[model samples]
Target chain A: MTDGFVTASGVSRHFTPSLPLGERIVAAFGGAVERRSVRAVDQVDLSLRKGEALGLVGESGCGKTTLGRMIAGILPPSDGALAIAGEPVMTCGASPRKTTTRVQMVFQDPFASLDPRMRIGDALAEGPIHHGLVSKAGAVAYVRDWLGQVGLEPDYVSRYPHQFSGGQRQRVAIARALAMRPDVLVCDEPVASLDVSIQAQIINLFLKLRRELDLTLLFISHDLGVVRHLCDRVAIMYLGRIVEEGPTHEVYADPRHPYTQALLDSVPKLVLEEGAEVRFKPIQGELPSPLAPPPGCHFHLRCPFAAERCAVERPTLRPVATGRRAACHFAKTDLNIITGSSSSPAVIASGAKQSS
Target chain B: MIDRASPLARFFGEFRESRAAVFGLVVVGLMIGLALLAPLITPQDPYDLASLTLRDARRPPGYVGTAGFTHWLGTDAQGRDLLSAILYGLRISIQMGLVAGAIGLVLGASVGTTAAYLGGRVEAFVMRLIDLQLSFPAILLAFVIAALLGQGKWQLVAALVAAQYAYFARTAHGAAAAERHKDYVEAALSTPLPARRVVFRHILPNALPPLIVVATVQIASAISLEATLSFLGVGLPPTEPSLGMLIANGFPYMLSGRYWISIYPGVALIILIFAVNLVGDQIRDQLNPRLRR
Candidate 1:
């Protein structure tokens, strides 16, 4: 991960909720003052090589969106160093501001992602014209080209956002980002809001655009199947921290982290044999609140193979094999804990530790 | 589902759908025209003391003046023609409302949008000030300001702007703050365009519909506020009599069976406000997405 193209090292984004007037007055009279900060993204290290697609997979409130936002230079990190191709993305000061234009983001909701008042052509051309990528006179043609690239009609440029369907709006959003000539594209569940048929078409568009533009992509989603299909590498997040990261095939085949193993096992599998019964074992335990995450491992309460050390000591993300990392105290141990039987898709194998 | 017309044309297209709004628009246009043409069309210059005669004072409607001109709406204590007084008053009242409303909208919308976009302590400070100001009655605030900066056209305007700006600030802050968190705004910010551009070009456009709705209603309020101040004798100077002053000047005669003095100007004021409010209501309904159908 060292010397990668897009790098975020030791990044942390903490947000303190402001107390309302009544609460402040109550606290002034010696009432219990609530001052807990939400650690949305805490001390995370991630690196994406140029032209490589990294899938950031996690359940809701796992901070995948916040991480993607920071990487795309939309939200400034509370603390960390983020760089794209050796150029710092955020300017350091009392209030950090995003300084780079090398990255752009695609939001999950197409309906809200576009300005309703602006015409499609104007929305797509706004960034390019401001950045001097195209002249005002040339913006129409530039916007049309980008629109066509995203499989939208050039004539659709004259319309407002409300005039388009969910699928069409997402296409327009992609074109708007691409018009900025961004080297890195951060898609935060771009197709999650679209119809199932539309999702496949948009996914195909992303695949085509990634190859054609040779772009470094950060695909953030909770859908494991989509991430597995689209991403080359996958990083699993739990309570604002990356717990495991590796090539998609290796991690899906043999998940070292117990959390990752449980997540994979939770996915329903198809049985082709006659009279084959399928049992769905959902991961046990609720996701702890990010406001006050468990002191040690965030996944300890949910991990089937959680040891005594897992509850007390925080496990750093350590190398468990070539091109793989897992944050678990027993990740490299010979503790054979069978969370599911052989019929279960994910059988915990202590054999990965031997390779390390 | 696409309309190729410009936004202004589209708004007008939608505006014409309501018959009452159209009638209000026509009445408003007619009033503005009457005010603008008052100097050439009025039979008398109401401000010219030399043209007045004390014998013509307190005449009932349709009385023949000594100058051989019929006072269709009668004369006040100063014998100034009520019709002429109202036309001139229209000019002053409309101008005060528009000038005050425009200045208030721009000043307060900027303050509010800036506060919302640059949130945290700045927002808290601006919002608190706005809240404190809002807690006071608008007319009371205007009265206080008018009392402090007494007896002039500009003074009343200043009072109206000061009194009404908090409403604009509150409205703009709410609209812009809601818009600031929308995905479009975040997407605009991610484009790396300057923050100023994002605030004005992106956030402001979406926030403006509500501000515009506020502006129309506020303009009507500003006009009424000016009338109230003038009636209280703290508004426009005697040299520049407005509708409220005319109504106030004629009030004493109302008990003496000479009702034309105050009644005519009061009726004019009501018509103007009614027309304006009608237009404002239609615009509010039109802009609200829930009532669009």
Candidate 2:
């Protein structure tokens, strides 16, 4: 594969659950103990060209945030390599440490993201001043400039995080990340906790910042509409694996994987016809425990079109269409059409687009 | 208008809204002021052996002594004026509590927060040590240390710090551990700021409200513990009378007809501890974010 500016090849993160106190003592005394691993991000190949916004979409526990953290260099992958501009972001070892200052992350909850005791100016200047990007004397003006860029007033500097409204705090968080002058931004559900109107405002701010800064973005969210609006390319993750990836327009218009289709199908649709009943069909079953994921295809148990072969054999992500890749046994054949599964609003939307 | 005020001014403003807290603050201030001004305000120097006469000893309240001085609270067995001795004792008690509590707060908070921030084995080791210290009754631990170190003002303060630091460490560890998972700490970690800065500047400040509450309460307890050790005759010596040592000196006189000697100093210790506790309670209420309107 061509090396994108930020390249992640087979990156994975696993968490081993510590034994209970009694069991730990037993294990310490040379007795056997069971330890289970949660495969948060299984081997996933992905890359982002410089200045491109890649939206990572998944269900709540599917590890989109984990992937974003790994890309941001805040979290080290348990396996595989992640690099920014050919420099490894983290050292691979038992105790992995992030090696780069080129990537930064803006977290989801603004109320929790900025230090409560910190003044807005200090919170914004902390990174720049520490990294020697700005002198202490210059940090005030530097902080003020970034705050203004994020649409906050320069005078709001001295106010603590609690003094600001949620939207204002989110703006501060964004300004703080940008103040670090990082080349890549991994925004882990940045606007997911905002009010709807505020979400639009922040999204627009992100759009403006991305254009002006030429920032590489790994935008992680479960919100499809926001992802479609902000991202140039989109990757759909399921149970720690990317099931489909393509240009945002193409993937939204023509998703190949069953998992991606189910996700797209779940998006609430507008039905304005008089007396027309709106249908609400959620995906069946719980996400199987990551501790002991099923053999072969992880999604096979929950898959509506799971065949015998799908239950016994795993599918690797491969080219399915122009600029699109999907991991499925029959990516070329459009399974929804073959199986005559529940009619997807996504397909109907695509049909409308083709006709128009 | 309130938003425009400086933080210190705003804190005081909010602090003033609690009448009980203000009252507590005033009483604590009076006690501290009286303690500091003991030598200047009191008529007799309680430690001046040349002045004290056993002939006037055990005098009832408001007796005219041979020295031509008014014994309002009477005198102890050594003929030391009860009021003068208490003021001196208050100074020693307050000084010891503040010194011990402040030192312990710094040491314990640093250790606990660092352990919590590091997590895993380091946290387990530090926390176990804290637990071990805490399992011993605070007074008992102080007694052992005071006995081992011998009776002196600074030695007593050292004992109190050793006995009291575990509480601070436990509180700090709990608060810092909870705060370690907060998004702000994670955001700090993502920055190139050193790990120490992340632990102290980012996590510690957020963890401090509870620690402040703990500090105030611990200071009050420190004063009480010193009193207990002295009452048991293991604390400050007679030459250096803390409230505890004063009470100890008068305990033998309590069985006799003269109640003024012991009762007056007992009252003083109660009033001091009460004032400290009231102030601590007010501080806890004011510092709690939930209690703020």
Candidate 3:
């Protein structure tokens, strides 16, 4: 929390979706309604300094989107604290109006994010006009100027979202977010829904916009390659918690945790050299349901080297190196090799300990 | 947008595309013109007691009645010129329809959007209320309302408004509820704009096409409701006879073999409702491009 622009401490978000009327009636009669709490994000900590971009990468359903939502002031954490620019924001569900202008979000679906009936000019200019940043007379030019910044032509200002291609609409969305001059932009997989060719163009636009605006970004995506391409630092999440965090290049180059190792291994070319051994080593077993995560380490059931310690006690995120942390008992022993390292043959020893 | 057709040009072009709507436009336009020009078109001042002769009553069509006046459609039991009666009656009916429809649309759209945007208990309560109101036949509700409010033009308007507003409310709520969940709507909320502007300018405009379709249909239904209430002798005052009252009055003469009195106004009522309903149908089809073919 010290001097960080956006800081989250022990932020957790849980969702207990409402049951249907029939189900509620049944539950009232002592019948089961199967009401299960989904812990989308659990005990997460994240800090983003001003003008820094941190990529949150995880498999689909990991808490990346939820965490990104909390940072954007869109969703409240069920438990924990979040501060933006050192001021605590209203969280859980009621997003206070004051911080709304400070942080803006770019949605994953461009088509769904811009009103189809509204002209692009109105969509982009609404924020500036709403906050009294620019008078209505000045909003036209203000909108056009933002259009150019997002690499869109000024002619697009008069067009509706349906009139533009998917890429162009994404540009409109970006311009709409930037029009407010927000300090932080939470992009939740902004490129995932775009075409591959359009993806690079949007990514480059984001990079350029960040430089020109000196904006802080909390980027959430499942693409590790894109994360490495755009982020200065990266955090890998498993289930509802971040399993590893460090400088993007360092984590990509030397992944510390077994899950991180498996993530890099799963990607065909994330770490593989041009002729390096390319193996499709996707982690074994289905992702455990968040409804009932295993007693100890969430990933231990799938880990090849699951030790008795891994099964008995969940390892906390321990700082193993400067600016690098991993939530695995064997992280200090270098998890790339199947066998245990010298410092702790305890990994295999504990397996025998479990068997004995 | 690729088409450089100006908005005005595009509007006319789209209007031309739907032949039925164009037909509806003409029928509705003619009805409005007739309503506005009723004073100049009527040969006799039907409202004046001095303008009538009892001997002219029950005259067949084309009859040379008192003062060289000829009954075009024929005379009623009161010697009122049948054509004159219809023109004046239509004027009142259309005016009520327009006013009632406008009031109903505004009330319904506001209630619907508020129900959707506020959600939670507000949504549940508003939607349930709309459902409860809709469960009863609209005309029956109008009957009870008109009966309670007493007979007058404005009272009829109030009854029509109550009868019709729920349609707009339900349609508008459905559209706004869906639009509220869209990403653009969420993005708007994430901004510093006032909630009113977001709901009115953004949500309402998107919700309008569906409500507009509902509005056109409601206009037809409103006119019909007015006629029904008037037939029950609870709509417009007797001095200002509506098409529905005319039909009810002429019904007594039907057994006597002179049918022109009630039949003429009945035909006019059907034409008006049919024209409005067709236009509404065309609009619904035009709004959804999926139905274009």
- TM-score of each predicted structure versus truth: 0.92, 0.93, 0.93
- Candidate 1 residue spans exceeding 4 A from truth: A20-34, A270-275, A332-356, B1-17, B289-293
For each of the candidates, what fraction of the native contacts does it recover? 0.75, 0.63, 0.61
> Which model, 1 or 2, shows the larger DockQ?
1
Give the lDDT of residue A87 in candidate 1.
94
DockQ, each predicted model: 0.64, 0.47, 0.59
Ranking by TM-score: 2, 3, 1
Q: List the residue pairs that clash in candidate 1.
A: none
lDDT string for model 3 (B114-184, tens) is: 89999988799989999999999998899999999998989899999999899999999999998887888
Q: Model 2 off-target regions past 4 Å? A: A271-281, A333-356, B1-14, B288-293
lDDT of 2 by residue, A1-356 (tens): 44799999999999998788999899999998888999999999999999999999999999999999888877888888899999998777777777678999999999899897888899999989988999999999999999999999999999987777888889999999999998999999999888999999999999999999999999999999999999999999999999999999988877777788778767778864688556444677899998988877888898766767677877888776667888877565333244222234335433543442
Candidate 3, A148-263: lDDT as tens digits: 88988987788777677888888899889988988999999999999999999999999999998999988899999899999999999988998999899988877777788778
Candidate 1 lands at a TM-score of: 0.92
For model 3, the docking class works out as medium
Q: Please give the C-alpha DockQ score of model 3.
A: 0.59
**Model 3 lDDT on a 0 to 1 scale:** 0.85
Per-candidate clashes, comma-separated: 0, 0, 1
